[model samples]
Structure formats: structure tokens, C-alpha cells
Target chain A: MTGLPMVVSAANLPARVRIHEVGARDGLQNEKTTVPTEVKAEFVRRLADAGLTTIEATSFVHPKWVPQLADAEQLFPLIADLRGVHLPVLVPNERGLDRALSLSATRVAVFASATESFAKANLNRTVDEALAMFEPVLARAKAEGVHVRGYLSMCFGDPWEGEVPVPQVVRVCKALLDMGCDELSLGDTIGVATPGHVTALLTALEEAGIPAAAVGVHFHDTYGQALANTYAALEHGVTTIDASAGGLGGCPYAKSATGNLATEDLVWMLQGLGIDTGVDLGRLVATSAWMAGQLGRPSPSRTVRALSHKEQ
Target chain B: MTGLPMVVSAANLPARVRIHEVGARDGLQNEKTTVPTEVKAEFVRRLADAGLTTIEATSFVHPKWVPQLADAEQLFPLIADLRGVHLPVLVPNERGLDRALSLSATRVAVFASATESFAKANLNRTVDEALAMFEPVLARAKAEGVHVRGYLSMCFGDPWEGEVPVPQVVRVCKALLDMGCDELSLGDTIGVATPGHVTALLTALEEAGIPAAAVGVHFHDTYGQALANTYAALEHGVTTIDASAGGLGGCPYAKSATGNLATEDLVWMLQGLGIDTGVDLGRLVATSAWMAGQLGRPSPSRTVRALSHKEQ
Candidate 1:
């Protein structure tokens, strides 16, 4: 009863770790069939009611690139006035940013990649070109008093390029921070990282003079190391994380990609460690069950499946 | 690169962590339908072929208590005499020990509980009474030159009593060691332990004059913290671990007892961090898939499932 060893920092534990629910945008984007706009909007409301302070409501990408998110215009305005929830939408380019801005989005996210091959495969541009492309959107958002989150995909490893270099990940992080983005999320696009790799990357970022508090980790569970990696990130002073409910979403291009880390599993681990995440476990389970019904299958989340079985 | 930061004890790194496979006995004990004796024997052969050095082949409990293992007499002799492999059986009382000795079992296990209520409910005896029951059996087994391992169930928490105290767990450990048991396994029986609890218990054991190397941890994945708990145990110098392949086994009496820590998942974590376990991942996956088919469902091992999907 020595009141938990004082080896780690306590000041960094945020009042609440803001969960940016990506189930609607990043989650639905990889679905084979297009989800109806109304169904997407209702899911957004259900997530908000489950104590989520922020949710990525939709992605305003071109229909050619992502037909699943084609109804972003219809879904964005439906829950725009929801109380106490910040709705952020993904803006792939200038056109996408304009659509989000037209709906009066308070927060928007822009994407880039750490490697040239992944950038070309995912965004139709080289690494430098993709980073340069987000400059205008970031500038426009900053001028209009809107917050922007910069996403650096394939931070640790890439599908085509194999092991991504540490300097490449740091260079993208610095560029995004310099472009007036408020937060930068380092994504493990293929989820090959172990806890050791996560600690090394975060330690490298700190040594490179990047603010640890402004960084978030997004992981896929392809290797079953996503939650363990998240724990390592917490040890390194990361406060915000990106996870999808029911472990939804898979890459359309990569053949072996799996869903992101499930929100229920992350919350379970965090709450058990007595870290505050402001999530209701019961509601989280119910919402995941409802979403799984919409997807016509059970969730890949171990926590959701285990708790649901208990209720039955 | 400061070289991985040496998170856990890697001095034991590259030293093969003996994964005492318990799938044959602990797994099938709670299964609903009785698998044929030949199926059980075949499972042991495939597991041995997968480079498992120690496998708990079966138990000698009466058919009325565990009907699933009633065919142990037939399955045991058939799977014996494999070179470099040790087949152990669980012996509850003198009758059970006599049964195992008749089958020429070289290794035997006795069960005790850390808490009085769990001991009474699970073994129909008090804590001291349960230990007393094993004294004569140990004497008889020693007379025959057989090794014995003692299982301390509910070392972390229990169904009847919540939050098992560390002192109680340590007392049980000392008793088992004093009784001439060669090894001791600490179980979370209900999967209610976090990493903090694991660190505290193992630290207490070291302070109480017990050699850390004599301990093994058996965890259930009910709360999704079993692997983390195992990591904490390894950090304290315990090497041998009890795991069921494909995350098999659950307690029939405990309400929420789910799967054990999956062997494939454990091997993946150990090998990724450069710990040797002498296991072939491909062959272990094949064995798990084979047993899963017999059980009429998929293996619960996430690593096997994820890797099989990649291979396909």
C-alpha cells in the first residue's frame, strides 16, 4: 500500500484522455458496401451519448477515392449541433476541406505519409508532395479559427517499403507541427510494432525535441500488439489515442491489414490501471454491439465480445 | 539506440522459456463433449512434434468428477516414450496418484488454493487440509522417484473471496515448497489481476525468502491483463509459464473465467523480444487449428488467427 511507485510522471495524466472516435470516418471508409448517411449519423449520435467528447463524424473525400464516405455532406449537418461534442471530419485535399468548412466544422484532420512509396500508393503523391499539399488546407483552417490534426500514416513501418526510418517519421512530425496543426497522430499503418518499438519511437521523438503531449498513437491490431503498444505510449507521456469501436476498418490497398485497436479494449486497459478516460464501459459495449449488428458480424474487440457474453 | 532499454530481464534472453503445454488436460477438462481418446492422443503427438518439451498429457480424476478425462488411462500409455518430452498428469489424492503411478507417469501435479473459501469450494477442504491431503501422495511419488509440481489456485483473486492478499499467496507458496514440491504455479483463477498486483505479489515473494525461479504464473484472459501480468512475473525472474495452446480452458465454477493466455501469443511476445522458446510458429498454428476443428470452433489464439489469415 505504498500508493503506487512514483517512477512515472503524474502531471501528464490529462483530466480526460480525449478519445477521437474514428468509427464513422476511418472505420466506415474501408467497408465494402456503402453505409447509408442516416445510419452513419445515428451511429455518431450513439457514440456521443456514450461519453465520447470528440468523434470523427465523417470524411469529405471524393466519391471516386472512397465511395463509402460519399454521403458526408448529408451526414455532417445532421449532427452538427450536438451539444458538448466536437465533430471533426477528414479533409483529403482542398475540395474536401471546402466541403467540411461549408458545414462549419470546428475541427478537421489532414493526412500525409512518412515514406514516398506509401504516400504515392495511398495519396497519389510523393512524401514531400503530400506534405506540401496539406499546407494550404492547414493555412486555410488556421485563418478561419479552426483546429487541425495532422496524421502521419505508416510512421513505424510501411507495407511496400518495410521498416520506416526514425528520421523520416520525425521529419513528417516536425513539418506538420510547423504547419500550425494542433496535434499529430503517428499511425502504425500495418500494425507490426511491438511495445519496444513504440517506446523507442516515442523516446526518439522526445530526444528530437518534439512535445510528447501533442502526439497521439493510432495502431492496427494486425499483430495483436496494439494495446501493449498503447501501454508503452502511455508510459512515454502520450495523452490522446485514436481507436475505432468494435475494431472496425481495414486498408483497401493492403492485402493483410486488419482493424484499428478497439475502443472497448483500450478503455478497459486504461480504467483498470486507474487512468481516467471518461468512458462508460457498459455503454461502450452496447454501442459496439449495435454497430456490429449493422456490419453483419461480431466485433473483433476482445473486451466487447467478453462483456457481451457476460450480459447474455 | 540504447538497445531496447532492457524493460524485462533479458539475461534470460535467448534462454528458451519452457512453455509447459497444458492444453491436453486443463483444456479438455471443462469441454462439454468428450473427445475420443485417440483424438486426445493425436493432439499430444502434434503438440510434441511442434517442439513442446513438457506437456500435461492428462489427469487421473475420477470419471464422476471430470467425465471429459475418463479416457486418460488409454490416452496416457499411447503418448508416452517420446524422446526429450515429459508427460505429466494431475493427481488430486492418493487414489489419483496411485492411478498415475500405475501408468508409469514420471511427473505428477497436486492442487491447493491460496484462499480458504476457494480451497473448500474447489477441493472440498480447507487450505491446510488440502496441503495435508498431498503429503502422503508426495511421499508415495517420491518413493517411486517421480517429480511433483504443486498448483496454487486463486493466488491473485478468488470467486468466493475477492482480492486475495499477498501474504496468503506467499504462505501457500512456502507450504508447497516445504512439502518437497519441485515447482509452484500461481493462478489468477478468475483473471482479476492487473500488472500492479502482479508486481506487488512477486515482490512480496522475493522479500519472503522464496527463490523467484521456482514460481510460474497461470493467468486467465477474462480482464485482458493476463499477458501484462505474465510480463510482470518475468520481470521478477520467473521463467516457466503455463499456457494452453489456442487460449483454451475455463473454470466451470467461476462465472467469468474465459481463456488462458494463448501459447502462440505468448511465444510471439517472447520471440519478438529475443527470448527463446524453441517453438515453431507454423507448426503450433497447425496443431491449434487441428484441435479447434475437433472442438467445432476456431482457436481463440489471436496470433494464430491473424497469422493464418495472412498465410491464406
Candidate 2:
């Protein structure tokens, strides 16, 4: 009947949460079509207009690896003029870090794997070897006085390895934070996690002296557990949540789902709980609906579909 | 990677949960096309075989009201021989109750609205008038040694009315429980509730002397808050959850969603938490997939979609 959600605040959650918007990078990477440079640039600008401050602009990987974002150089420059926003670029290695630095990208993130299977499959290196690779990148970024985020994939599960051990994840998270990285993002890449696993990981990290404040959660809605997992993380005092605009990363209908949690869905829950995310829900929905038209499919976010349909 | 969720139990949760399956009744009533009586019977039989103990088979309302389930009398007898299952049919009034009692239905439910707006719209009676109407029905069911469940709709939000008050809901719940209903199912008709609002309501109910054990939760996924809200209810010691097989009631693609929480999605979370539901995930997925084929569309359940794709 209507588009908006009724606000009813929950307790023991952070007063304000900082959403790390990843629609332009992670979302497009999994898309079937390669979005144009101008459209991608406009997406970042629109995301900022929707009040998303930390929009992940694009990844600085090699063209052969991520051909979709080959225009990282061109894309970054177009949105570089956007003020009051922190644009973080994914830096795969020292060379990727060099490319980001070349564009004057002030924030960069290094991707690591909590499990060995993901490390070898994704980076062609073992967990320790990948950590060794990021050492130079993080050190250089720290030396350059740039903000750095370390993303640990397969924190809860791995394809080759079913359930990753909490202690194993804790060791890798410790290594990243102990190194020159400023913060960490726990990735439920396969989205097999429940609330207990999330609480266990966060508790382990806390015991290892990593405060929940320094960590962000990146959950995939593969099993419809992303929002529930987000609620658990929020209760544990996490301040950062990574979301894709329009749930753009992977289509849920596909067998191999890279379904990042939808940003609009996350905003709806946060706003209902009275947790301020500094996001304008209406503008965000409009941006996602517009992007869905560009992609030639309906936006997967229920809130986006519900609201946009009413306007139509 | 795989279809199954990794089991990791959270503490302080109930050891087992009893799911009240509503696919045959709540799910199909909102469908654009009406299902045949034989198919509806087979659906209930399949649900029982898949390990759902309590199934809401159909409503005894008049055909003019819900033409989709006009064959309740013809449908109930076909599955009455199925053993060890409770088939609950909705009895709208004295006529509905008489029809259900003729079929030897041991369990029946009466629907009431927590808000005046819904009471007027759905029942054509005010809140107290609706309850007054059920007074005779509850007494009759009690006299017949039948179990009665009181369903309080619009407990969270209303379309015409934005946010519902917690006290108003508790007062209605107490009325139903005090009258003769053994238990209550609180409905989030619009699905606008946050986790905090859920906890606040349950706490309020507990303060009113309604133990968490005597209540169940029914959540809709209109804004995708169902699972997270379910988790909140579980934390508060709720043991009964109402779900629809294949998420039958409403299509998320439709603008006006009557999306019931998918049974498979709930099983995924409950199974991952190492909680016993006695449900076979593979069989349940197959059942929902088969039902989706009957409905000429895919199931809205993310787990059902993800798991069935792997089997293909």
C-alpha cells in the first residue's frame, strides 16, 4: 500500500552507523554487462547525492583480471570532484596501490582470505602468502597517509572448505590489523553464516584486542541471513556495514549467487530502528531504480521495488 | 558454493522450535489463480511428510470472501487421515466454525485485528465487536475439546495508520488469551517492524503475564525484515514460527506484497543454529520447488532457489 517503513527504535545499537557503499565496484563486477565509464561515474555521484559518504568507486585490478572496471582510471577522475565523500578503491597489490595513488585516491582496501582455499583460488596464493603480498601495499598506504581497509573473505565459510574455524579467522584478522592496515571488514563471501558464528568471530576478534569499532561487516544475502547477521553485528557494537545499492552485485536467481546485501534494505532496517546512517531513503531508492533500468532488470531490493512501483 | 548453511549454534535459544506451516492457507489465499482441491490436499500431505507438524490447511470462510479456498470442505477430508499432524483451519464466525466442526477438525483459528482500521476493513466490525463475535466460537470450540489459536493482525504497522502502539496490541492479545484461545500468533501484516519493536512488544506481553511460551510470531517480508525480526523473537524465547512453503502467499515482485516468511529460509537459520526442527531440508526444498512449478513461478525463498538450482 505504501513505500516507507515505520520507524521503531531498537536498543543497544550504535547511535549512528557508517555504511560503506560498494555498489559501483563489487556490484558491477558480478554483473553480466560492463557498465559505461560515464554511467559508472554518474552512479558514484548519485550515491553521494543519496548521502552515502564512503562510496567504493572502483577496483584498481589488472585489466585481464577485472575487464569490467578497466576504466578505473577514467571513472575515478570523474567522481574525484565530489566533495564530502570518501572514495575507496580496491587495491589488489603494490601495483594496484600505485594505480590508486596515481589517481589521488585517498582511501584503498586490500582483500585477504580467512581460509586457505579462498586465498589460493582468488589470489593464487596461500593465506600467509597473500598476507605477505598485502604487507607492502598496506605499508605503502600507511606511509602515504591514506586510509586503508583490509577485507577478509570467507570469514564464516569457504566453498572448498565448508566452515572456517573461528580461531583460524581470528589469526588472520589479527595479522591484518597488526600490520599497517587501519581497519578490517569481515566477509561472509558464501553467506553460510548464522548469528552465532558472527558473534563467535566478533568475540574472538575482541579477545584478540580488535575492537568491533575497527571492523565492518560484509554479508551476502545468499541464504537470506545477511540482515539477521547485520543485526547481530550491530548488537556486538559494529559501526560499519558494507552494502550494494539495489543489491547489484549478484542476481539471486543465478545458481552462483554473489548477492551482496541491498543498501536500501539495510537503510530501511536502520531507519526503523532509529539508528542514523545519514542516508536519504527516497534518493537512495530513486538511484537504485534508475540503475536497475540501466541494467535492464528490476532492482532486487524489496524496498526499491515497493516504493518505485507506487510512484509508477 | 553449496546449498546448505554451516551449522553454528548461538546460546540462550530454545532447543527446538515448532513451525506452524501456513503454505496451504495463508500462502495460496493471495494467489492470483486458485489452486484445485486435490492439489491443496497434496500440498498438505507433502508438508506433513516434510516434517511440519502444524499445518494451516484452509479457511472455512464463505466462497464470496475467499474464492481461492472455497473447497475447504472437500479439501479437509482428503488429508484428515494423515496421522500425527494438526491441520488448523481458519473459522471466521459461527458458520465457518460449524463447517470445520463437521469435518471433525480438531484445531481452528479465529482472526482478529489489533488496529481499528484493519478490524473495520477485514471483519466489517470494530475491535471489540470482532472479539465479541469470536466469544461464541471460542466457547463452542472449547466445548468440543478443540484447540483454538487467536491471530492478532496488524500488530506492528498498518497501511492507513502508520505505527501501532505496543499497549494496544498487548491489550488485544490478553483479551484473546483470557477469553479461551490457548495461544496467540502476532501478525506483522505490513512487515514494517524492527527488532527493537519486536523485543518491546514481547517484553510488554510478558509484563502482562503472557509467557513467551504461549505465543508465536507471524512475520511478512514486505520490506525484507522478516528473518531479522524472527531472530529477535527467538532471542526473546519464542518457540513457534508461522511460515509458508515456497513463500506462497505474496509475490515479492508484486507491488502489494503479502509475503509470508519462507519456511525453507527459517529452516536454514534454525538448522544452522543447531536447533532441532525435525525438517528435512532436501525434501522441503523439493516440495517448494514442486509447488513453485504448480504455481507457474519460482518460489521467493532464497534457500529454496539456491538449493534447487544445485540439484538441477
What is candidate 2's TM-score against the reference?
0.98
Assess each prediction's global lDDT (C-alpha) against the native: 0.78, 0.90
lDDT of 2 by residue, A258-282 (tens): 5899998899899888899999989
Candidate 2 backbone overlaps, count: 1
Lowest lDDT block of 10, candidate 2 chain B: B249-258
Candidate 1: misplaced stretches above 4 Å? Answer: A1-16, A31-36, A250-257, B1-16, B250-257
* Model 2 C-alpha lDDT per residue in residues B113-182, reported as the tens digit of each score: 9999999999999999999999999999999999999999999998888788999999999999989999
Model 1's DockQ score? 0.25
Error of model 2, residue B280, in angstroms = 1.1
lDDT of 1 by residue, A1-312 (tens): 111111211223444577778988888897775778888888888888888888998888888888899888888889998999999889998898999999999999998899998899988898889888999999999999999999889887776777777778988898999989999899988776666667677877888888678898998766566776776677678888999987778431233337798888777666656677777778888888788778776666666776776677
Clashing pairs in 1: none
User: Going through the candidates in order, what fraction of the true interface contacts does each contain?
Assistant: 0.13, 0.57
Give the C-alpha miss distance for residue B67 in model 1, angstroms: 2.7
